[model samples]
Target: MRTLETIIIGAGPCGIRTAIILKEAGVDVVVIEGAAPGGKINIAPRVDNYPGYKMISGPDLAAEFFSWLNDAGVEMIGDLVTSLTKEDDLFIVQCEHNTYKAKSVLIASGTKEKKLALPKEDKFFTRGISYCALCDGHFHKGQDVLVIGGGNTALKEAIFMADIAAHIYLIHRRNEFRGSNKYVKELNDLPNTTILTPYIPVELIGGDRLTGVKIQNVETKEERVLDVQGVFPLVGQIPNSTYVKIPGVLDQWGTIPVENKTKKTQVPGLFAGGDILPRDIRQIYLAEVDGKMAAKAILAYLEK
Candidate 1:
């Protein structure tokens, strides 16, 4: 197996940032990513909060990050890490194609979206079902669409879809929204948007491509089906920590608990950062900060 001083289990903003820092510090490090390097950021339509860019598309920002990685001489590998284990004094990383040994490992693996898991949900995915409003909303322009959830993501996406889709039906399981009042008010003000409360998705209705969704009232047994060309589910997120074989490092929510300053986990040689951490704010710049912190901590760990 190949050997290295450190291995980063992702190639998203955090992992790439960490690798850049380590490589510039003359440390041996490589980043392994299962999918595209940008992680979930690739699906975002526009990012207005990140520093240095007043307004930029998610893909453009990701490209800039990739360029920075190349300038820093950091190496990235396109491979999925299946498992991570510790043996003797080295960490063993098992991937789909190869295995490697490292003195330390950083888990920057991000989170995945929570699904509705209703019947035929899998069959209609990408056909008429989607998780990102910005990614698939354009395809259904001038058409009717459905947005599910009461969180900020769902609200913001519903507002965005208002300009594109002819009509939008926003459904939430609770009568009140979990998002900020600003977002809720903005979504409510949209003339093309309709808010339905205290309802849960029951089933998907369509053949081949989805034509509608069936939802049930949470308190009552009342059910209704909305006719739309697309359905966007923006409920919540789940951490990608299944590959971590180490115990006691993961919390009840499957997120990693790290030191506030160092981003160090319970294990000495294993660290975690980015969206994998249990932070309320999941932003690009914050993830980059986690990477910088973890890199500094890993360097100290390697020196000892």
Candidate 2:
């Protein structure tokens, strides 16, 4: 088994940033990512939000990050972390082919994009359907689109769509929205927003790409189809925290329960960063800020 001073369990922006900081501080750190260094960045269309880079493609941004990683002399092991075992106050990281020992672990896996249940969704993804409004919304400007789910993310997406799209059809299975009332009122006030409550998507119709969405009313069982070239799924997100099983600080959803101001998790040496923990805002900038703060806490833990 290889031994290291610290093991970063993700290759996303957060993980890479943390590794850069630790290495610059003269700390021995190795980044272990399940996939490539830029986990979700590989699929992101274009990220215009991340500061310093005015406009950049996902792969381009990822490439730039890898360049910095190289300069920092950070060791990257592109392997999936299956599980973590605590042995004598150290963490044993179990991957597919290798096992690593580290004094501390930081989970920056972030939130995986939520999927649409439609079996055809997999086949049509990136062709017309998208889960990220900030990434794909501009492509459908002045065009009709369908927004599914009723949570805060969904409502916020609908609000975003209303800004550029000519029209939007908001569909939800519940008559009452699952998102906060304040945002729901804002969505309702939009002129182009059409609320289709108590309805759920049944199928996506299109020839080569998504042309429309088929929805049915749960109460009346009535069927209706909305014509559109784009479909956005803005439902809630699921955290990637199943690898570690530390006790006394987890909610039912496996998210680390931490104090609002401090990013301390249940375990002493273990900490979480990015959108993995539950919070009102999960923006890219916020996640990056949280990752930096979490790294500070981790550094503090190592000192004591």
True-structure RMSD, every candidate: 1.9, 5.2
TM-score for candidate 2: 0.71
| TM per candidate | 0.92, 0.71
Q: Model 1 over residues 14-96: C-alpha lDDT tens digits?
A: 99999999999999999999988878877776676588888787778888888888899888888989999989899999999
- Residue-wise C-alpha lDDT for candidate 2, range 10-75, written one tens digit per residue: 877778878888888877899988776776776555565478888677778888888988999999
TM-score of decoy 1:
0.92
Q: Which ten residues in a row have the lowest lDDT in candidate 1?
A: 40-49
Q: Model 1 has how many clashing residue pairs?
A: 0
**Which portions of model 2 show Cα errors greater than 4 Å?**
116-199, 203-213, 217-222, 226-232, 260-262
Which structure among the candidates has the greatest lDDT? Answer: 1
Q: Which residue runs does candidate 1 get wrong by more than 4 Å?
A: 219-221
